[model samples]
Target: MAYSLVAEIWSELAFGMLVFALRFFTRWKYSGFRGMSYDDLFAVFAVTFWILETVSLYTCSAYGNNINLSVESALAVPDSEVPRLILGSKLAYCAWIFYILGIWTLKGVLLCLYNRLTMGLQQQRFVWVMMVVSVLTFLASLLWHILSCYPTYRAWQIKPYPGESCTQRKWNYVIICVLDVVTDIGMMAIPIPMLLRASLTVRRKVSLVLLFGSGIFVMICAVLRAYYSLVLIDDNTVALGWAAREFLVAAIVVNAPSIKPIFSDFKKRLTENYASGSWKSGTGSNAMSSGLPPYNGKNDIENNTAITSGNHKRTQAYKMSSIGRSQPKSESQDHINTATDADNDSTNSNIGKDGIIVTTEFKVSRR
Candidate 1:
């Protein structure tokens, strides 16, 4: 009894935590991208499943310390009191319907994520086909649950004779289990080929797809649940207990993988923030200035000094050259013309006026 209670508490806590974590991760990873239709729906389905599982667990007293016989014994007082217990049991069955729907919706969300990540029109079409098939299976499962026992209340309340009650159809359980296994397998298999073609490094691609493939654990849980479900047909006390245990275990296992992506995104964000903060604090403004070559420490001082000195020298030279070029051009031109005329007259005096005459040209000769 104590073990049962503990398992019950653990299951509740685990499912709640899984739901929170899955939402955290989904928001962290996909929230930045706009128009994420399926992710939100996935979160809703997760929350719904968690709620149904909690209600079912309580209604069935699956987590409680009392055994089935004890419950029956406690409620053996009067016919009037039996209805309440019976009602509670019926509510438990209804919760199961929700639980099954929750699982089916989760499968849809997973496939949608796969579809978003996968490339190619063909693969996308395949995912859509799977989605349609899964929805149909969910509907079929729901129909079976609703119609399994004619006057379904008989599935809960005991009849006059031990064997006379209209119970759930055996084929319904079989079909539900089969549909579950097929969907689980389909969900697990659909993402592999697309993941293999991802441009990420081989290691990263493998790791990511494997992380997604962790949903197969759900399939494993489903298989175990299905096996124990067979035991439920006998309605033996031990078999019922085992079946409940298996159901809780499978439910927890399947939801457990959803937490990984959430925690992964949290870790990544923390890492990026830490690196950015460290760079900001350590480098300061110097880093920015250093990025420009002209502002580098040694070169900046040298260049500044050279620029000041060169400017001063160029200013002095410009003043001196301006003053020198300020002379009167007309006076300079007249002086040059007078010197040229004197040189011509001297040359004509040395040579006679006529053709043969420079005969008496004064030539100073030193003895």
Candidate 2:
């Protein structure tokens, strides 16, 4: 039973560490570790507090848990265990509160991301409203958690005390659970209508929907956590494990999106490496820069540039030349010269499809 408690702590800790590594890597590599956003800040806070809460859970389990025992056996617990139980109970209570904060903060991370994405739309108003309501709910929940018991201190009393009373929080916790799931669903659905109306292709819309749909998985985790908490609410040890698992899931759900750009960039780099390695001669000084096999001299480089600059024309000529051997060779050369003349006559402001799009952009100018 004690091992079970420590196992949950270890599991959550490992998950948190793994996410933290990814988050940190993403920020360092993509964001240039500058101008941190609300989501970034909330992720760090959620992860840091979750780790602390895990340590607290470990402390809470220092004394062997009394979960799932007969009522009679629970009553017969030795007086010597009470002090240790009280200490553990206090730590567990602290962890419970921190866990709630961590979940809320993690939710904030996603909500903030949504807010930024919808900032220029009518739905932005709805996003702001949701954020306000979530904050108020979080504060109210915190207040209720603190004052959850009569005489408050009685809530943490490992031993029974005369003239002290406490209120059962089973239904109260169920209410919190319902609120969490509802809010999660609302947040997940907020972008759909707007995305549908946007000037995007079906493929883009579907991708956006699926990206936001990830929150549904987090909602499932919340539902399961609620079920377990309600069922094992009477058992401290079992409840602690559920709490840890729920927190880890929330952390993963919120932080996963932030690392998407990192994975995309890595994939892009691999593609570039493969393409360049296959197409370019590795022996040249500018080998890595070239997308095609090695050329002989400076003349070759200039000729290659000219060919690329007017690839559509070259391709057209090549196709025309292949169409019939009866076509005169001088006519093909004439076509190439005309294409070269057209390239020289073009300007940046009047660029055509043959011109480069210049995809290499300053990051600061992008969304």
Pull out the clashing pairs in model 2.
none
Per-residue CA lDDT of model 1 for 19-55, tens digit only, reads 5565555443433234335645665665667566556
Could you tell me the C-alpha RMSD of candidate 1 in Å? 31.0
Query: What TM-score would candidate 2 get against the native?
Result: 0.69
Q: Estimate TM-scores for all models.
A: 0.59, 0.69
Span of 10 residues, lowest total lDDT, candidate 2: 329-338
RMSD values, in order shown? 31.0, 14.4
For all candidates, what are the clash counts? Answer: 2, 0
> What are the runs in model 2 whose C-alpha is more than 4 Å off?
1-3, 64-75, 161-168, 276-367
In angstroms, give how far residue 359 of model 1 lies from its true place. Answer: 95
